[model samples]
Target: MLTSAIWLPATLAAGLFQAARTAIQQRLRATLSVNGAGLVRYLYGLPVALALWFGYAAATSAHLPPLSPTFFGFALLGGLLQIGGTNLLIMAFGERSFVVGTAYAKTEAVQGAVFALWLLGEVLTPLVWLGIAISVVGVMTLSLGGKGLKLRDVFGALWQPAARYGLGAGLLFALTSIAVKRATQTLGDGDVVLRALTSLVAVVTLQLVMQGSYVILRERGQWRAVLGSWRTSMWVGLLAAAGSAFWFTAFASAPVALVRTVGQVEVIFTLLLGHFYLREPLKRAEALGLALVVIGVIASVVGSG
Candidate 1:
């Protein structure tokens, strides 16, 4: 019911938040590459996400699901993997524009559907496969449309650091999806509070670990950067957090695979924002790619139904 209840609202929220995030990513891409800067931004975003989840939990009087060491461990591991994936994506953004970076992110839909079938024993009908195929085509169209690269050139670009990173992120994102579902099961609460709380703790814990480690290493002596980054990036982080929370909250009610597959709407949001706000050019090839992805998502929804 979360999806139906807040589906349009959540999607709209994700769109607005991602728009801002894309703008920040493009600005950072101008000077900083995605790897380091992207990671920093993700870490910064976690706290904002935490605050939102906490606020939601308090307002709803949502019950906390019971926790065990095993559950906590899974949450931590999944959070780490997701953060790592986001880092890879940031690196990808450095290589290309937000559109390409987002197209790469859509790979998670296919990855997640497969993982759900394998790990959660979730059923996928022929229609689901069709949807996946269509979505893949759309994603490919999006990625290749903007650049004038031929088919071979596009494949060759896969070897680039950013593409590799994006793929890596997608894989990790699939893993994160698994972890979240597992976390949801552990809580045994149909409400979104427990899941939100678990994610809040997990992300915050990881954020601290990553930041603390950096502080200890004095790697770049970027305390000034951290402080400055927080001021500019906190809200972006909050929006991403809200997006994550709503997504999983929706997951609490919907089929995990369906939720994730449909959630690929983030790519559409990212690409549109990339073009409108970041002024990233949309080429014929990319337009065709986007069309393919949209068609695929439609098929997926129908297939899943």
Candidate 2:
């Protein structure tokens, strides 16, 4: 029988890989447009995703899982939302510092809990809910930064570009998480790895087709930019594919809410990456917020475990 224990490690790996992918994609913004950078993820990752699916199938001697209408519907919706969510995140990078923008996006855990409970019927324990609350407070603290804890500044911060884009991105990401979980469920009983790879291949292919068409029609000039940056784009593709594989596998193994809440470790990873690599300084409030996030993550894991 599959155990939720599998999701803990899978989600942690996904968080680390995703943090690296976001950092690389942020750098790509220098040479490529938002759409261009986003395109590189799906366009380049398609082949890698296909290879992963085939490699798993061949190694296990597993045949292709039969696809159902429910799977296609959920996968397509999830793919589209994921593309939108990614672009929104890229836009947030332009509006705020890398770590701060990512902090705003991390609000997905709170929103994801609501969506998962409502749409996926995955209920959370009281302890898990407390962990989610603690993590969300930490995220808000990060958004506030070193500003005075005044009501006006707090309210005004939400209207800022970073908050706007990041919250929107979080919402789309939450929806995508629900849809992807639903898609995996539709595959019925199977090897969890094969089910995840199959869903990843289908979702990535749909993203490429949809996003590629848009890039071709409206942003034709960006094609040269995307290809020109193949050196860096390739890294983005590799990390994104690796991260997504783990994410899908986690979804198959555990509740979406639990997976996402634990995935909050991405915020901590982003903080270190921004400080050491990008030379972004950490402030007092931000440090406190990071501490809370860490504590919350530990609580969440224990609660779920």
- By TM-score, how accurate is candidate 1? 0.85
What digit string (tens of lDDT, one per residue) describes model 1 on residues 1-305?
13245443453454456556656655654444334454555566666666765776788887666778767776777777776787777777777667777677668878887888898887778887787877765775676655544778679867877678778888988888788768667776656545755665675566557654655465454544555666555655565665666665655555556666666666777777777877877676666666765676677667655
Leading candidate by lDDT: 2
Steric clash pairs (candidate 2): none
Q: Tens-digit lDDT track for model 2 on 43-157?
A: 7888889889999999999987889999999999999999999999999999988887887888899999998888777777788888888887777777777573578887898
TM accuracy, model 2:
0.96
lDDT of each: 0.66, 0.87
Measured over all alpha carbons after superposition, the RMSD of each candidate to the real structure, in angstroms, is 3.1, 1.6
For model 2, the stretches where C-alpha displacement exceeds 4 angstroms are 1-3, 148-150
